[model samples]
Target chain A: MDTDATYQAPSVDEIKTLLTERFAGKVNVTKTETRRVYATLPKEIVHEVCEYIHEKLTFEHISTVIGVDMVDYMQVVYHISNYHTGTMIELTTNLDNHDLHVQSISDIWVGGNWHERETYELFGIIFDGHPKLERLLTPDTYEFYPFRKSYKLRGQE
Target chain B: MAKDVLDIKAESAVMDTDKMWIIMGPQHPFSHGLWTLKIQVDGEIVKDAEPIVGYLHRGWEKEAEARSYPKIIPMADRLCYAASMTYTHLFCMTVEKALDIDVPEKAKYIRIVADEICRIQSHLMWLAAVGTDLGNFTVFLWCMREREFFMDLNVRLCGARMTTNYPRIGGVRNDTTELFDRDVMRCVERFEKVLMDDIVTLIDDSSVFVSRMKGVGYLTREQTVNLGITGPAMRGAGVDFDIRRDDPYDNYDKIDFDVPVMTQGDSYSRYQVRIEEMLQSCKIIRQAVQKVKALGKNAPYRLKVPSNVPAGRSTVRLEDPRGESLMYLISDGTDKPYRLKVRSPIFTNVSAAKPLVQGCRIADVPVVMAMIDMCLGETDR
Candidate 1:
């Protein structure tokens, strides 16, 4: 029933400007299409960026965390959303194989706690500052980080 | 504390205050899925609660990476078994978005209608479950009777009742038959006639039902927002946010429907939201059937889709029966996906049990959790 034409949301460009001003151009938004954004930010600024999204932007809905093994590096994707404005910003951060870790945003979004835990176990990415980061979906004895490209399963390459 | 633990009857004479731990499930009727609730109890009142999930974890996301785009649809269908059509359609929508495939107009209408039918069925399934959970066997029977119509309609539309792997990347798998629209309209009318009077009265007229659901399991609107709760649970907290209208997909924008919100964030309010939602689902199905009929003699349903999709990533969100279901798809310019990440609504919704279930009695756990309508298949996936 929210058919408000006057509900002017902050455009992607406006958000990009805010990011530039806040993080000193350290973040780069790759694409903005239909409420979804693909972006890369400094691993250190991950917490700050999430805080900004949670507080300043009012995008308090942190849906989940996803991690991908991109051969040379790992991609950490956080789906942050605002139900009112219909803004979905997919915050992406690249962590090299050398250091498969990044600061956690669970403090900003408590819902991100489980997501981070699941991501940590499946993709083996360490989320620093997460209070209880452990194996979530997989058992403690289950050794492999099955989501990684290198970890092959039966009947799978 | 140790003294109270040792001398049970003696301590009962005095101000006996002691805390003990209780594991509710890996197998319990209260838990709808393969999850456990560890509660610290002071007598009957819950001191603190922690939800343990992942018992039903099938590693669907990891499995999706190895399988082709189309191959994963069947797996996604099982994401939320109560509403299989919605999950499969959502997966298809994500895949279509990643590949930038244009769905045919008729197929879009079919998807919309089928999705609403699934919603009605899922909500009815939840109502039946909650009824059984709260000792209202009659309500459960009535809800299941009403739900049978929708299940029959689903079978008429697709081949299966629950695991309806009907939606495809480009469009739906097949076209609708003449019996689909006629049968759907007949069912909706018949359902509406009996929905308020016969079925709901079984739960509503009962004084015990009102007392059990009225003010129990309270969640504030602020807490709902901060905790990332979605669907009826969030709406019950008086948040006017419905993804169908706010973030429209599959001709939902064109269809005129109202999103229901209630001020009380209690068990009763959540029930009210679901009841209103079923009516809206019926409305949506009627209008969708009209749209399907308006297409007249001939209309394209299934658009041709390639086995190998172009490389791209898409983050898709939709209001599934339970809540806002999200699918993050990364296609690698091949038939198979690089990574397919699903964030099921019940995962986060179930995680909020520590906040929602705290301070209530152990007996209230079933009513509190049953209102959440947990499906661990999706949560664990």
Candidate 2:
């Protein structure tokens, strides 16, 4: 999904500069496109970015968080929306699929916990510090991650 | 003292014993479409509950990617069958947003009428099912009798009953007929008196229903918000947040009606809210019908949508009869959507059952679940 209509877009340089100034280089801001910015930071800095966006950039609500498998890597996308400013920032991170480790953002937004558990159950993504990481939708005996690209549907493998 | 010690030991032994688990259907009376709930109960009192989904999962998101833009309308209707029109309307609105298609004023008014009719029919069905759950079969008969009028009205307009694939990507399938307007008015007038009185006599007057439902399945406003509950359940919790009012789609902003919120947040409150909501829906339908009649048949009904929609994501929230139905549509400038995610209300409402049924008796489970009135198709899809 690429957009070419660059109408005074938010500058990546300014975003990166702000992140560096606030987070002291612990945060890595990667530019996906003129409109999409993917911020990857240490698990410890998740709260910091969440807090900074909520307070400074006015990203008031977490739209959704999608967990995807890149085969060897697991990617978690935090889709944040600034309803007042009409801007969206998709923060993403890649971790080893087997490790599947990350801190929970439930403390920031209470709604994040259920979605996180759903992702965990579907893709085997592990939220390290989540309050309850037990199976949310699937059966307890469900062994395989159902949403992975390689994960075959019934009788398809 | 020795007997007391022995009694304590016997109770501990009973608690430690292996409990029998019963798997209630992906097909059952309680389940509408397809979903399973695994329950571990020690003789009626449930110790634990787990919801098992993905039975009716057709991977609609993947299907949407393969289907052309206009072709996905029918599929959206199948997501929530009871309120099929709402799903189709939401999908159309989302695609219209992506393609930047402006619908005609006449089309908007017609759509509002159709959707409000769907809401009335859906709530009527809910009332029937809720009545059936409470061991009152006559209410179901009365509700179905009243509901047939609207169903016939819908068939007269769109030529279908349950699944009316009447809404299109740009606008709607057809213009309203003179007969359609007459039948709708007839249905509205009949429902205004008969159905309201029947609901009050059948449900509100019954002491059994009141005793069983008055304080059962309670969810506080704070808990409801935390659980992401929407629609009537959230309104029953006293939130007063209706998408029709908060984020007005179609001509909901122009219409006049109260959301009918209840502070009790119990099963009874939910039933009362839904009963009141049916009346409010009738009011909206009356206003929309008036608007449609004024516009007449010559008003524009069709719209033109671009072949390649703009590459953007849009989230459209509409007030479905059950709850707040959110559709997240992502397009990559192609005929097919890149991702189509549905945030169904039933899924969240059903999840709240885990907390609602924690200490209640087993007999109360069915009544409590009926109050939620979750359609398994919506939850699984």
Residue range A1-157, candidate 2, lDDT tens digits: 1122222223445555666667777777765433345677766567768767655654444546677555667777776644333345667677775677788877666556666877788778888778888876566888987666676645555
In candidate 1, stretches whose alpha carbon ends up further than 4 angstroms from where it belongs are A1-9, B1-17
What C-alpha lDDT values do all the predictions have? 0.86, 0.75
Each candidate structure's count of clashing pairs: 0, 1
- Off by more than 4 A, model 2: A1-64, A67-102, A106-114, A121-125, A131-157, B1-22, B42-44
How far off is each candidate at the interface, as Cα RMSD in Å? Answer: 1.2, 4.8
True contacts kept of 2: 0.11
Leading candidate by lDDT: 1
| TM-score for chain B of each model, two decimals | 0.95, 0.94
